[model samples]
Target chain A: MPNATVAGITVDRNDEGFFTDPNQWTEAMAPELARSEGIDELTDDHWRVLKFMRSEYAQKGTGPTVRVLGKTSGVSIKELYQLFPKGPAKTAAKIAGIPKPRGCI
Target chain B: MTSRIVILGGGTGGTLTANRLRRLYGADEAAITVVDQDDRHVYQPGLLFVPFGLAHTDDIVRPRARQLHEGIEFIESAIDHVDIEAGEVRLGNGVTLGYDVLVVATGARLVPEETEGLLGPAWMDSVFTFYTPEGAAALGAALATFDRGRLVVNVVDMPIKCPVAPLEFCFLADWYFTERGIRDRVQITYATPLDGAFTKPIAAAQLGGMLNARGIEIVTEFNTGEVVPGGRLTGYDGREVQFDLAVVIPLHGGATYVGRSPGLGDELDFVPTDEHTLQSKAASNIFVIGDAANVPASKAGSVTHFEGETLVDNVRRFLTGEPLEAGFDGHANCFIETGFHKALLIDFNYDTEPVPGHYPSPVGLPLLKESRLNHLGKLLFQSVYWHGLLPGRDLPGLGSNMPTAGKHLPVPEKD
Candidate 1:
């Protein structure tokens, strides 16, 4: 598998499967990767947005625009930007492992 | 040359700070300029209630540029870098904005792909998150079709915006599924990396008891490793839980621009901010607030509200060559939804945890205990958020410092 490193952190191409298949992205794997990235804790707002992004992709087949995504998640656009400054399309897709998103790239 | 104040983001912190400054300083004294890539301003707290159909997506959004005071100039561009020594901010558009003072409120970012397999094929199929309006609507649709099986809500990592929201989702989900008459068919699970449901022990005990009473499964210290497709979550310990639908909270980091700005932020992009002063450790001229500051307080709207007062004062101090006010008490308050038409309220700061008592005064709304009044307070805050919070108006009796008068003191145990 081709490997990529972001800011010195190694990311394997096989890791793509981690987000692609719901069955493969297990709770056990999330923290290991997070720890490697140096994230030590999980907050409820983080889960709310991540879970919402997945559902949005499921029903709409695409991530919501930053505006819509923020509203749906109950996070104001200011707050959403505060939470995901890259915008919802990129951040949500990245976390959901859905690709760079069509318009974002 | 005109004295310049450069704000890195046009979100809550930037908007409020600019407006408040515009109110505090004459336009000629300080040329306030706010930079952001887009003009869309979202009502963030509304996202949590969207999936449950309590709020419409359109109701919570507005143009970013419109929210600012008349004197503030909005620059629509992404920040390429901040040259702190030169006292200038370089934009992606090639413009250099020089400033006498700067506010770094670019805030945090969510990176779900940081987790292995989280962004894969089944991302939106059986897995979801509601931090966005689109995610909420999609979750609403997914929940509509879900008839039965295990439903798990997991948090990947912390320091996210609104620390109580996921718990609210769990509580509301219980109400949502029950209303659909499919509550029994859906087994609800709450998983976290913490040893308890929350960080604060006292609040965790209270909330943990409520979850237990609701028959919702609580899986503590379950650090997630990956999301196995087909609804199973694998933990760091190799233990796996199967689910029909999985909700995930991904890892969050500070804005990318923070990394671009030398010595401005941490390895994770969060700014090395003074907890008490809200000033960036890298430079005295730079200040931070909201989700961007790496303070050990709950990253909620109330924290920003509290920080706003102290931050404004400190900025004033910085301009006047006065001693920077080290007055921020890490005060953070939030409303916790407990389902079945009730909610709980808690207020605390750095040295204190949430305790059961009345807030503001000894006889006011109950705190650290469930009541309908708190639930109404949560609902009312939405309106207050739009009208009161974003506008930089001070909420009556609710200031930056947490009032200790009405809170119940921790009971001492016999040694």
Candidate 2:
């Protein structure tokens, strides 16, 4: 784990740069994190998915899977990919400052 | 009148809980009954070995009723729905059983139909899953004749029982082919939805390395959306992994009864449970165990065995009007069978990731490394599961909580 300053706020992150603690994330940091993940801007659609990911992580210990986010996040699966290219659920979770959704080891 | 306790499912968790509870209460105090649709209780772990011709259906399957203690009752009937408000479990046969405490151990159900085209024309002929007796037997026949081609093992989604089995299948397949002198002909690939070979970082790196050394390709973060008839797994993200033969671990959900009984389960039909207490969020009188509870631990048999101690104690306390003990720590111990009579053991809990060490005691079985001793331990566990674990007898040096004495803690890296 390592601490890095993003958007002028320090936060703890894992080796893959995912947040070790979800509470360290703030709205101000979303844009910079989004930028790092290749998103030039945080659109209203991006925020919707990110907010959903954060809230779901708050409820469940882990983040939601793509199927889960597509079903419940009010974002169509196609649009989710449009919002966050490649892996929507995983990439969105990265921007939202949450650990990647995982299977139990 | 004796307090009636009805347990759902006659599988691992249900059998152990009923037997354990019977030991705690006299027949005059608590009348324990375990119910399932059929009398067959399959040693689920043996299913992993079935495809490799190491075990047979007869070797794993046993009568569910035979495992229960003398005082415990066993009923073979389909669970229709649970009326939580009325405190009754309605059977498909039109019988109603009332209970003061309901232990929901009805484990995870395989939903192969959930995935698009998974059960298509190519099913069984080329695309196979070894999760069930029928599936395993069919796969065994298929693998016997499978001489050359790319063999892909794909895990459709998460929360599956025995998450390590697919990886084990890959390792065993490599050995199985090598033994048949077709190792060079058959190409093996492991595709999973997770970001790595495993969920944990360290274990993922280690397992990933093993797969590489064995010449098995790993495709990570690939969520299977559709399985084309001839031979391709199309990801939702439009990536594809082609295979000549595919062994798929389909999506899993809680038993259908959970979906029928409103307010009983979550969106996925798993009972929302207290991770520490094993008590269902549905009601105070209902307790959940094994894969049925949406806990963060691996849905392995070792997890159910570890949960048994805390769950039984909590059930006793809940019935006697005592405060329930939040004793369960999501301890899960699993043995990953690599090829050639070698296996890797991992012991972990909710807070701790598995590291190199020994389990149960400092001198006990080695952990997080492959060895012949762990393979023997894996084989010997079948007997332990039947004679010891299912009967609810406590094993010396092994308890509900994870032991820390033998485990080597990772040194903290300076920031």
Candidate 3:
């Protein structure tokens, strides 16, 4: 419930970094957030996947599942992993101004 | 006074060791007693099948007392601690036991709480483990509703019981979802702290290829530091893996009683044992076997089967004031389930890794390769485990030491 400042943003995050207030995430904080996750640069392909997750979550109130992302997000599951390393969905959710999608991937 | 033997634990090791020692010393020469926390003796390997509905919980569990020899005593009580210097053990029920020879076989205990946030909000909801009967049953139900998303099977750390089990789970999951007609909807992943699929190169090469054939993604060197309820696994190095369903194999340590008994165990409470003799390094009169021993060999049933020969012989030698034979070679045999009505078998010892070969006979079961014959052999072992194995009856030609009679060992490639 506490708001911790991460990547120059005063954001509320759970202990494991699930965002409490999705609105606290700003475009300005993404580069630092990306650096913390071991991604040196967020390329155009990464944005395509990240924006797809954000647009899907804003409409459905939940991020797209891995299968849905592979089929509809213009990126395959293998490609999604290449974009976000170990955790594609959760990591994308963090940077896309969305709460960590609840209830298993 | 009759030379009394006290075996701590009622699992595969204790049951077999107690029975074997009784046969070796006869009723008049020695008295054997086995102690455990409960009467439930589970066929541990069968737990893997439970999640897929291939094995029932009741079918895999039996009374611990029923496995012992006729004259051996079965104590249905929890152990408080053992006083090694005093040669006595105190039970939680206020019972005291004294032994001329002590056998510590109280195998590894699952420690999920050791990992940060593992027992968190999604403990049994999305995050489930199949290492225990209850966990397996819960995962079965979770998998029933789970038709989509990334399903990850992660082994928390190394030196876990049944090392191949996590890989076996991944293989079976492929078959399970395929049979359910929703294989394409679900994504399968296997995450381990190890650098590869298995410990040995030859077997890992084959098994790793099998995983790729099934389209299951492999996440190697993933040392999970925590599990968040939102279906995320965080690694020690700050990487993370997200999953819809997670089947976790937690770290294992020696039993709690081992910690209470001073000078009896390693830092992890696994008894520091001589690999060849099965005798505890702590004391000459004490011996350790099965998963309880801090041996380099696997903590599996076949290791206990092979150790029984040398362990019983050493007990007899100790009673008669003779030198103990360093007969055990840390031989281990494992049958890995690759799903789809086939399995792979491997045989090894302290020196040899699994290679292409035949076991026992030159034309016997295939090694390091999947075959229907190996699958049948694995299924047949349930009966053998109950009848021949626990009774300490050794299969002829299957000795404590490994043989290279028919194995095809390739020369090491230049680095």
Candidate 4:
């Protein structure tokens, strides 16, 4: 784990830049993290996916996959890509300040 | 009074649990009954080889009752629901089975209808799934005639039983096509929801490299949304991968009866279990194993086999008013078939990822690397599963916990 400064506050992150301890994250940190992933602004759609991810992780001890976010987070799969490019589950999870999703091999 | 034990689903989990418990307790002390809907217990791992024409349904399929030990009772009936409050399992025929302890091992069910257009007009025609005996037989017939086209193996969602089977399908297809001298005419694609060829990083890199070498195109992070028969697969992210022949692994949920039972299942109907203890969170008297439990381990037979060791012991303790030992370590050992008479073996647990080494001992079968010996092991396992695993006989060196002696841990990356 390493300490990094984002949104003018220091937080613990893994080598992959995901928050190690999700409790250390705050809503204030989403903007700066979004910018790093090349999202210029955090729209309401983006927040919807992110908030669902955090709340799901809080309850399930794991972040939701892209399908779960698309199906239940009220975000369509097409729009999830536009909100978070490349990989929606991987990218949104990082910006949402949560650990990477765990799927069995 | 004798302790009454009722186990649900006489598949791998229930059979093994019943056999192990029978060996642990005499019939006078504990009366054990195993319930399942049908008599056939299809060796699930054999399903993978069926599509490749290496195995047949008759070879793998056996009567569920025949596999159990002499003393254990086997009941054939559809499970209706679990009356958790009353500690009873109600069957469809209004027969009620009261138990001092209940083990739910009904396993995951393939719900192809969960995906849009998966079970559409083209199903069993151009599109197929090899997860079931009929599906595998149908796929085998379809594959034999398939000479030239875009062949795609798509995994619809995660936590599917035998997570590596799709990759094996791709590998075997590559071998099958090459053997037919039409390898150049056919193009293969592997589409998965995971962002890599596998969940483990090292194994993914290795398996991904094999896919690249075999010229198998891999489309990652593709969550399948719809299946257009004989045309294309549309992902939730709106990415389309065209396919002439599609072998789709559909979304898996626990048995439907699980959903009907109160406090027994999650949204997906899998039992919410304490990963370490294999005890259902729904009640202390209930335990879960195999694909029925929502544990983070791969939903493979090896997991159920490993979990059996701890689960049976804990069941004994649970009956005696002793403290339940959190003995299960989520050890999963899998033999991955990479085609062309070669395969790879991986041994891992909840805490450790697959690493390069040998298993059981330093000189044992190689792990995370392909070898002919491993392929033989994979073939030999079918017999071992029927005789050794089902009978609850201990596999000398292989235990409930993962062995770390032979593994070579990856060197930390220099930042």
The residue-level lDDT of candidate 1 at B198 comes to 78
> Relative to the true structure, how large is the alpha-carbon lDDT of every model?
0.77, 0.90, 0.85, 0.91
Model 3: residues with Cα > 4 Å off, grouped in runs? A1-105, B412-415
> What TM-score, computed on C-alpha atoms, does each candidate reach?
0.79, 0.95, 0.79, 0.95
Deviation (Å) of A95 in candidate 3: 37
Where is model 4 more than 4 Å wrong at Cα? Answer: A38-40, A43-45, A69-88, B411-415
lDDT of 1 by residue, B1-415 (tens): 4578998888788888888888888877889999998887777778877877778888888888988989899999988989989989999999999888899887778888877789888788888888777777788788878888898988865556777788888988899889888899889999876667777778889889988988899988565668887677886556687888888877777889888988888656878788899998889999998888877787777888789888988988998899998999999888887777888998999888889989988988899888999999988987887678877888888877889899888866533
**Roughly what TM-score does model 1 have, to 2 decimal places?**
0.79
Residue B333 displacement (Å), model 4: 0.9
TM-score of chain A of 2: 0.92
DockQ of 2: 0.52
Candidate 2 Cα deviation (angstroms), residue B65: 1.2
What would the per-residue lDDT of candidate 2 be over residues A1-105, giving only the tens digit for each residue?
Answer: 678999998899988788888888888998898889889999888988988888898887788877677668889776787888778877888889899776355
The parts of candidate 1 lying over 4 Å away from their true place are: A1-105, B411-415
Candidate 4: tens digits of C-alpha lDDT, residues A1-105: 689998888899988888888988889999989899999899998898898889999998988776567657887777888888767888888998999886544
Q: Compared with the true structure, what per-residue lDDT tens digits does model 4 show for residues B1-415?
A: 6899999999999999999999999879999999999999999999999987899989999999999999999999999999999999999878999999999989999999988999889999999999999999999999999989999999998979999999999999999999999999999999998879999888899999999999999999888889986679997667899999999999988999998999889778889899999999999999998999999999999999999988998998999889999998889999999999999999999988899999977999999899999999999999999999999888877877999899997776654
TM-score for candidate 4, please give it.
Answer: 0.95
Ranking by TM-score: 4, 2, 3, 1
Cα deviation of B30, candidate 3, in Å: 0.6
Q: List the residue pairs that clash in candidate 3.
A: A105-B243, A105-B244
On residues B134-228, what C-alpha lDDT tens digit does candidate 2 reach at each position?
99999999999999999999999887899889999999999999999999999999999887888887888999999999999999978888999
